[model samples]
Target chain A: MKQKTLALLTLGIIFGGIFLTMIVGAWTTENTKTPARYTTGSAEGEYNPEDIRGSYTLGEVSTLFDIPTEVLIKAFNLPLDTNPDTFKTKDLESLYSIVAEDIEVGNESVQVFVALYNDLPMVLTDTYLPTQAVELLLSLDRSWSQETIDYLNAHSVIVTISEDSESDKDSALATNESKEPDAESTETNNTTNNSTSTTTSTAQEATTAPKTEPKTEVTTETTTEHKEPLIKGTTTFQQLLDAGIEKAQI
Target chain B: MSKLFKNQPKTLQKKLSIRHYVQFFFFALIGLIAINHTLVETGAGIPFLSDASLHALCPFGGVVTLYNLATLGTFIQKIHMSSSILMILIFILAILVGPVFCSFVCPLGSFQEFLGKIGKTLFKKRYNHFIPQKVHDVLKYLRYVVLILVVYVTAKSGYLMFADIDPYNALFSFWSDEVSVKALIVLGITAILSLFVERPWCKYACPYGALLGLSNKVRIFKIKRVEATCVSCNKCTTVCPMNIDVANKTTVTDLQCISCMACTSEESCPVPETVTLTLEPLNIKKPVSANLNQ
Candidate 1:
């Protein structure tokens, strides 16, 4: 046969095989329906809002900690229904707390893991941790507070914290412990008038104040002593190291 | 004596290969059937085939689908087959590959090219000058606009307009006795145009080809001319179904070349190592000659 004829024949055979395969694939293959349910326990679990617990559905974890659910599901090989509702309240809350702590320490993977863990419900099994998540947690933002630092250290995790030079540690500690007296007195008076309002306000203030105070201290210290505006939102170095220590426990 | 006689070129034998024209006829036949099927409901007229259905007979479509899946993040679904990503990728690939789907793969393109050869033979003098370069270039862009419009309408309305209008589908359906009127219209227009000009639809109307032409400049595999060896023969240029001037340039002109390799074939351009397809850089020193020694 001529080379052209042979080449054409070869092409025809190859195309014929491919055509047959395609026909088989399309004909035998049921028109791909939107899976009534995604494959459970596949590399990645599907996202279903129904899996989340209570009113707290998994919003954008990526925004909070830059963790994609798709990555977590694939990495962990989590079950399909392993959503936020499936996890015990304690597990979910603990996961949330851990993520918060990881944020303080700047541990990326731990933060992602916690986010993913929190999103999963308590019931489903086959959980796995991603190496990327672990790597990310180990390299956290180092400027955490002393409380966070102490917590991390006790947990046996190490972290670097940015320090505040202007902060007279001794005075700041004294002020933190002492300044509460005036605020507590005012709070007490308000509590007597409207206990519910006072409690809610106090809780909100307590959560927010701690985060901001440490940031302010770091900024002040960086400007006065380090000659820089210590990267904002970073916990004091002591706090971050402590946060890492706390994570080591889990 | 018979061998010697056979070796001598007779007047009819000197004509371009009839195989391409035959292939072109088959393409037109298919197109006609497709259009007829679209117009009528008789299963015996022309088979009507959907992209999904034809996907069974043509593995190339499946390969194309897989390519769409990888690049476009498409999930295969039955009811809503939105391979927008695939469509986009096809467009992008067309820009880079010079509408290869049309030139080499598309049965429709093959048919059109075949008809174009016939048009060349019948209207030798009148059809000598094809569409003007600038007008051709502008018209080439129409496919993108059509693609965009078709895709937008399909996405928004959830209808497969292209599938209905595609001549290839119309032709494939002819065997099954199912034809699509829209598809038939498209095929009819394409066939009529082919009679007037060589591969007219490919040059001006094929949206897919338009995209390929845009990307032809960056294709990894391209044709290069060895100017020094060229006997300045314009035979390559004349024989080009797409009306490209293959003799002059180092690189195949972006708008004209389809990588069919017809011009480079031994029978077409008998230059010794003059025109070649290569992945390597072109040498600029050698100037292409216009006349062939033959």
Candidate 2:
């Protein structure tokens, strides 16, 4: 083809492909990091742990892996008040940046935790989890090969859980009253206050709260108000009241 | 300014070619898409226009995600189905004419060429000849290395590793939060270098360009030089952006050829239909000994 025809043809093909994709409802532009499913083994058709992204929230992880949000929070030693629905797994990178330079305790750790919790097969990496996560995994009555336990022992990072004094007191109280099934949850929190009090104080100074940006509040009020008749240009007070405005408020 | 032009002969004013118009269209479209993407993120953009991210629009993303898609059954993060579709379409075009995307479509190539105009005026005859031909021949192969490293790393890490340092991404997404400092640095260096060189990135560093350049060897339509009507003036070689010796070659199968058609008879050749892009192959000349024996 000549340069002119080539140029036109190139534009036509590209635009045509895009238009066709849009018409076929396959033109995805959003950042949707959907985890890939396993293709083989007992976990066939199940979500692969390796496909877990840093963008996933703890709540999403909980739903996907069938793990409790509380267990995740406690295992990771996240602040007691943290909203699991908003807390991204990437926050662990910043939260443990001091130690992460040596051993990364971030999204990969979450993947490992989820895999072990569900007893699903996984490709092992150099990813490390908190000591509490290791302990929680060991306590489970699952089919734990000695090699896996040894691997967990070697990979466990002993990060001092950093929280304020009031949360520590509440954690201690919860631990005292906790039942058998809820024992690990309280113990994970209680360990933060009981041991390494000096290190905990230092770690508290180093650690910052995980930043969860406020979700954009979509306002429907403008559209709703636009649909309503405007009380203007000789409109009556009775008309305003009929429009759903209280007389006293008006 | 008067002294500069006083003794100089008046040259013919160059008009915009079909290629120039195509370049401007893509450059403007990509710029608008990037801005629209950011505006849409803030919930205040034109609703009808596409607000796809640069990653979503880039065919290179599709190239990088191939291994991950095959092995893991998923694309790299931030890349989507559109990238793969665009890749397929671009490859089809490449197979037909060879990397017309680089000359007629790439916004980055156009951006560099835009800077190269200023370089042409400043350096005059010396423009696009900053590097020695011998050194350039060796340096041009670096882009292949870059392509290999990018593909390998992206596959291993399951991330777009090149994104952090990609000058093309930085050029369009400089104002956005997604642009990395390393990418900005690379973009800045590329901009400054564009004032001295013609498409320095495409010559020595563009992984995508390296991938597309391979199409030159297998393209259907080829740039062929006629041995009979060819003037020895070498205008085709002088006008070549990639510094290819087009006048000497019977068939231009140079890997660096973007199929820009700059060296074609329609563009730079003094004789009509002498140096042309055609599906027909040039006649191979018989050797002197073979002709004598015959």
Candidate 3:
């Protein structure tokens, strides 16, 4: 109980616990046949984002997809010297969350990788990219604006030009309609989650523009058998589960 | 309520403990809402209210960041701005008082304290049971070890190594998919132990608590004993959740002192001015009794 004795005992426990966990972890790794959450084995299944956790390293994702290392770094806005193998996906998410919070976005919740995976611009409209682009993405698009998006999708072209050149063309061809997104349509946007929205925003704009087609094909995730009616993205998982979605599909 | 207050003024302590209830309610509600993903998937929404990503203003984040920066020469994550700012805020508060966050604000700490009350009710006089005094003393320092390990492993590896093992994160995130067996086991064990020991996680496991404990040693304001009006009554020590020897020490320099102010409360320490919280340095004595008399 003496302070000196206590201090020595404390140190013993501290070092002992550290040594124990380290040894045990190593031993477990050697003995156990458990697979890593992320590994290069596309034969197993397609890359599903749901399986992604904070433990998955950025290097793993890059390797899995054969994505350029610099592109991944640019997407996440990581330091140049940062070891991709050592840096986890959550690190990028954490950084994005901080920036998101700075912009008065939610607490650490923004999935920045979704943007990278979907091939949207690193940053959305009206925000600085966390880090400067180190390489060029071989895509062809004017600006992210609606008119340019419509024209590009009308031609079904890509964003292949340099950003400066594209932006110059965009200024010349861009429709400067500053109208707010209608709350009814914008607010009702449940199907286009972050990934889906960023990916389909251009195509959707092209089809929706010109107001020529009164009979627009509304792609919905509804079922005819359900009498009470179920909105696809809006229903809580719990409510869905209660409604027997768990028995069928989640 | 009026009749009860008039009959038992001492019960002011119980009434004042409403802050715990508020903290408890806030956490429980958030925990529930976080798990329920209806609002998030339901469609167009303001991103601020619905957060699905792991981590939300946990100060433990800053400790891991410090470790990563020190060990790896880079942040564990690219952006730790929120956590860095949060750590700065908490440390500043730690310097001003002791670990007031643990006692007043931390939902996890509050949850454990509430569980500790259940332990007290079950054990009665034997409620404050611990291991052998020497072993207990040693065991109490394990949190510091956890603190170091969490930082080192997180920094060395590319992940928040403590995430799966963190009881606080586990408890709040049970409804979330992040709940691992390790966290559940630790949380279950700690929840069980809380009935037998007060603030078991804070005293012997939490890395954040270990960091904040330093505030007791160097904080400007301290809980001091005025030996001039000396009384050896052990009421303060008995009430101290961290179990510091409050009565014996002339000034409580124990890093375990959480500044709950229970020792300085009127209900504790029968003699007024015997144990007082003072801003003056322990080296320079103050006229605490005169201030009390006035």
Candidate 4:
């Protein structure tokens, strides 16, 4: 080929390849959607659930809950299947009532989850649900009580709670073993005696007779629990406080 | 006679032209200012013009700055707005003056020219030949594409992309403790390319050169080859730093011509007033003789 002809051919091939690549790129981009990851404690401003992807689709909880699908999606961050306009209007009242009841009872997770389910259209498989739930929980700064922790552990939810606050250190280390039937009554009597001794000690000076009595009561309580090997290993408030400080430094 | 005219032209026995001295003085002044800014411990960083900022002011600066800004938004983001504008204006002036920016103002171009001079002193000639024109022309378009992409990204995402790899920033950054690894890499590449071909970046890679060429076509001051007075020696083209055929055409305003005036110098081409600086209309004169030596 002549040099000019060869140059034109080369240019044609180069441009054609670029055009094809761009078309393929656009097609692929539209088909594949990657779900966004949510993080905790970082949502500093007003909690807009709409900003959280895969939360809610429409206002209707029944059609995903009712109102409009757009409204529900903005408010709750849910995933939905169908168009909001096609949703049955009759289901709106029942879904709204259910959501309201759940919210009043302080079922925040269930309300939010329902909201998300209604709005976002993408199908979140069962495999990814727990991970998403854990992320939502962490972001909301909701602490897990012992019951909640046990439930999550049983369900194999990979949850990581932030380190305990300084003030909660003493209570965290306190051991609560199942009390024996006879031990409960004795414990109540011991608590009454200890309270009375504490009151008297505060009114009197350290050298007075009443001040020494509280020390004896405390010793007596320890001796009763000392008989049990499990109770003997239980940490006191002071010991736990010391351990927390040491741990923080390390 | 040969010993007396070793570095001097046989026709014009002049020590150094006033124009050369003036250019030398201006270069020294700019270099001193750059050094001062680098050394000043005001805890305020070194003040230098970014390519993008330069592009906004002058056609040459604008083209170079635009090209860099398009490719390296992150680097330009750090440049002060005032300095950017000043550099851009300087670039515009350079367009009118035939790449006076590269010869006198552009720190990177000046440094490369200095390096080329050192190479010439050692080797007594150019270390290598120019890249093929076809390949050079194609690669030149890369700067434009890079500029477009960078500008788009910065405009859409509010990012500065070109500031990182601009040679000017790389040179000034060495003094200011603000050298980016990316900028250094680009500078290294430009330097390596320069070793093989004189002013490789200016000839083949500089988008600014392309812009200046446009202004140079209508430039008031231009190198005019008087073919009637010319012997077909090809000496003018041989000594041209930018590799333009200064002896053949009435006007030498090719895109690759940096207006370094090396061809116009007496030592390079021993033709008295053959290639003179004039304000004449372009393409009026015809090619008289072919200088095959070039």
Candidate 5:
């Protein structure tokens, strides 16, 4: 009822509430395993490349996933010499706004940007890239120079296919021979090299091996290895991956 | 023209009152912040200050999220955690200072004050001239109704219904696609009405103001009139934007008092120690001492 009493009471409520929230917040933050939302940096520790979100900057992502920062910047058409970690999806949103408004700026499709920069399964929709991203990508002018194509190849899709014909299986096995004897238990350096090369180079390297004397047969096999399953209607890049296509092959 | 005006002390003299500076400071601060947000969105950005935009800085968003959290057990996704913290800070300030945020910090309030200045010049003697006292007394209660509706719909729908109609959001987000047509219309009407009525939206429609106004009844520090020194001069009553009857009341218990301090100023009151804002000390039998002033 008295003014002093009321003032003290009000002060008590404020200090008390603030203390409670701080204590709770400190404890919750200590226990939290997930990265804080809306921030980007490597000092926060690494996360799964597959699980990477739009809020992360290119530099943070480059360090975590070990993707080449230059390749990614080029793929996204970012201004040269940008600190990858310094820019995030929020910045990209800024770029999008400029492209829409300012005549001085040029436009790029966000779908193309995401697809080429993030080699993992982000922006996917089961069989393909996300539908909205796909729609945007359709109108984009993707100037895939041969080198850019190689970078994309190295970061390409997973192999979930099991329905290959017996002969197709034979060729897939043949490509694994260049892998070192010890690490062949899972995949090896050979597959990475094969996966990173152009389609013709991979085929040429596969055929020229001394163990394979059947050159014409190997050429036909390589064509079937790539072209046959891919031409199927509705088969997306992801589906090609599901059918055992590598980045180099796709 | 009167002896009272001549007797007004020079201590509170100002080309611009504290409230005017506060209004000017906040209006400029918020405008610059809004521009920063837009520039960041457009990629001509500098990595400094805060990356969170104008909407994140609004405390009212936090208030709505708190209501949604209490009633629906889920926080609105669009409302940031920073907003919730800001809401708590505002509540703290209200309890201590009796809704000074309405008079000083809230950009919308400052905007209304700016328009009110233009109205004062254009209408001269007819400034704040549209509404009668009787009609205004009844209409001022409508903000409470709006408060309830905003909380209810936002909780029930699990979405921010208030953002669809909030004029502050409209002002900051006018160029963005997120700006609601209804909100823009409300903003237009509020700006126009500001010319005829002081703080039209704050008095009659702002749910956040309705919530903060409650602090006037129970806030710790308050503007109090010293009856021993008080004259029957009604100068304090004329200066109050919220129209509290400052001369008639010993303690400003009116819910509409925004703690702007115009009434307590020496220029407005014409006497020192007549009006003060402080916690009432325990049964004092003598005049205020030097230690008490500290």
Candidate 6:
């Protein structure tokens, strides 16, 4: 090919490909905003914890993770009147900017909190959670592993609110003292998880306080019972039928 | 005294080559897009204009994120599907006709060439000749090392590590807050060096250029010299920006060839079709020796 022909062809291919992708809706120049979901294993279809970003709003988090908005507001000690819809997770940085040194709380702290609340596995980094979040998690009726309790205990940062004349408060750090989380005292989190799954009103009531009474047997999909069978590779239809599904269902 | 008209009719200014137009088009397009991106971020951009970030438009982002995409099924933050598409298209172009993207599309290469004009005027013949041939030869391979290191680090960290030192981003998105100080410094150094060396960054530090340079060895259409009708005035070699000896080589399989065609018959060669970029290898017959029977 002539040099001129080659040059024009190069431009055509590049710009043409871009144009084609644009037409086909594949040419995205920004992130999808929605976090990536797990594509394989037991967590398939569940949103990946690591894919969360600082741009996510508290309301968006509540919707995506099935976590209550009130619970998130309480966990982070956000202002009662603050709308979760407009509250960006990244705002936590400036909100806690005046906190004591060596212990920082930010978006990663939210990721940690969400992961622990939903019992989703997440890669633990040097992320420190706010003490309120840790306490909120402990107060719920959920069974946490000893290792997780230890992790929460070690990584919690106590943020104290100091209101100014304008009523704008900074989540200030009071002290660096490490306090043990009371995980065993709460029997309501697991019971709440069951009741919350049953009705919207019960879920709202469960978020009000940690119920002390022993609850009915929980039937909601716990982390351990959520795995579904996946047919893969050379698994035949005959084998699938024998395993139990009817031909009509298949 | 009427107007002095003793000199011969002025020659027509040399026509801007197709390659120059292409280069300028991309350079301007990217510049506008980058600026528009900043404007859009502030909620004050032209509604019809695109506001894609430099990383999204850059094919090098696709190259660096290949490992991450393969293992994690996601591009590095800030890079999007457009980069991957451009990367694939450029790869296809490279396999067909060598690294035309470097010469015809990359704004950075065009920017360096623009600076080189000043270098040519100031230094004359001494321009692009300061480096010793042996040292130049060794330094050219450094880009490959850079390519490997960038890919490894980006893969390991699941982030675009190259952005920290990418002079291309620094040049195009200098006004943006995303431009790193190290990248700005590298761009400054490149700009200064362009006054001495031709494509200093492409020859030494551009990881993407290093990746595309490999295409020269196996490109379907190559820069081939017809030795049969060649008047070896060495004009082709002299015009080669990469300092390749195009006059001597029957075929330019050099890794540094950017398919700029500066050394081709259509551009610098005095003899038509002598130094041509063609798909066919030239068929020049060997001369019979007169004293073979002795």
Clashing residue pairs in candidate 2, if any? Answer: none
TM-score of every model versus the real structure: 0.43, 0.70, 0.50, 0.44, 0.53, 0.70
Q: Provide fnat values for all models in the order shown.
A: 0.03, 0.65, 0.00, 0.00, 0.00, 0.79
**Worst ten-residue run, lDDT, model 2 chain A?**
A197-206
Return the top candidate by DockQ: 6
Model 1 chain B scores worst on lDDT over the 10 consecutive residues at: B76-85
Error of 1 at A13 (Å): 10
Instruction: Give a tens-digit lDDT track for model 6, residues A29-86.
Output: 8777677776654456888656666667888888888899878877876655556776
Tens-place lDDT per residue, model 1, A1-250, is: 1224423433354346436545665333223312122124321244422222211222233323335554443232222233522222112222221211222222222332453333321121112222233333334443444532322222221112113312322321222222323332233223211000000000011112232232211111111122121111233546434434333432
Candidate with the larger lDDT of 5 and 6 = 6
- Over 4 Å off in model 1, which ranges? A1-30, A33-250, B1-52, B55-100, B128-130, B174-178, B253-256, B281-294
**Cα deviation in Å at residue B227, candidate 4?**
1.5
Off by over 4 Å in 5: A1-250, B1-14, B68-74, B281-294
| Chain B TM-score for the candidates in order | 0.64, 0.92, 0.81, 0.69, 0.86, 0.90
- Clashing pairs in model 3, backbone N/Cα/C closer than 3 A: A95-B79, A139-A159, A139-A160, A140-A158, A140-A159, A140-A160, A141-A159, A234-B42, B119-B195
lDDT of 3 by residue, B73-180 (tens): 333442243445456666766786667667765777788887776566556556665655677788889988888887778766556667778777787777654477
lDDT of 3 at A225: 34
Residue A186 in model 1: shift from native, Å?
A: 85
Q: Point out the higher-scoring one by DockQ: 2 or 6.
A: 6
Q: Alpha carbon lDDT of residue A11, candidate 2?
A: 86
Docking level of model 3: incorrect
Docking class of 1: incorrect
How big is the RMSD of model 1? 23.1
What's the interface RMS deviation of candidate 4?
19.2
The deviation in Å at residue B27 for candidate 4 is 4.9
| Model 6 per-residue lDDT tens digits across residues B202-247 | 9999899999999998888899999999999998888788988889
